[model samples]
Target: MMTILIPATVAAVLGGFALRIWYRRWKQQRIEANRKVEAPNSYYSSRGVRQQEDRERWHSIKVGTLHPLNREEVLRLLDVVDEDGVSSLSRKDRLFLDNMTLPRMGV
Candidate 1:
């Protein structure tokens, strides 16, 4: 009787554990099934607007058709950097500095 009772108790505990695991997996699957997936381009829809504009401007500058910034423009940019620190500049401002200081790749 004692031997039979021990085995029965062990089997009951294991059965309960297995049932619990199955219920949790079922719950997770239901949650996943009900979840709404975002469109691939949705992430970029509103994000990076400024970065995109900066890239377009940089590309235009790199085309080399635009004349180099005049002396006054350069001075104004420098003064802003000097007074407020470099981080105060906008993306366009920073890109202008990049274009002026960095050597042209081919020429």
Candidate 2:
């Protein structure tokens, strides 16, 4: 009984360690692959995201009206910054984000 318990415990510990290492390596590989895929796409993320669902409602609004970035767009932009770093933003996207940082009126 003692020998069985000891081996079982050792196996569990070793298995946990092996799983941890494999998971770390797997995560690194997946992240590298995603970065490679997204490298070219990082630019398109800022300006060309087509909000088809939202656009249906916005169609009534005049084209020239200054539309604020909606909640999801803000979150996606933040995710882009988190993933790719600040330098990833185009000048226009950077300025747009900069303007977003300003204090709002009557809040």
Candidate 3:
């Protein structure tokens, strides 16, 4: 029984060591592969940066009036305005729309 236990313990220790070595090698290989894959010109490169800047410039020009509605007020307004006409909308709906939409139009 003692002999069996000694060999079993030795086997477990060796198996754990083997697994650790295998994992280390696997991790190193993965890192090398990632480096090789990312060696080409990435989005952080100069040309990519220039392209991103150009996109931002175009977006600034084309950006129309976008009202930043508060989530709570927007939900409240949605609740007040049903499928009926604007006349059915509550005072809260009108106020919510006025507060949100006017500033965004640069009014």
Model 2, 48-90: lDDT tens digits are: 2423322232233333334545544555565676677665657
RMSD of each: 9.6, 16.4, 15.8
Better of 1 and 3 by TM-score: 1
Ranking of all candidate structures by their TM-score, best first: 1, 3, 2
* lDDT of every model, 2 decimals: 0.64, 0.56, 0.55
Candidate 2: regions farther than 4 A off: 36-107
TM-score for each of the candidates: 0.37, 0.35, 0.35
* Residue-wise C-alpha lDDT for candidate 3, range 33-79, written one tens digit per residue: 88845556454557556434433332243113443345555544444
Model 3: CA > 4 A from native: 36-107
How does residue 58 of candidate 2 score in lDDT? 28
Supply the global lDDT for candidate 2.
0.56
Residue pairs of candidate 2 with colliding backbone atoms: none
| Clash numbers, per candidate | 0, 0, 0
Residue 105 C-alpha lDDT in model 3 = 23
Which predicted model would earn the best TM-score? 1
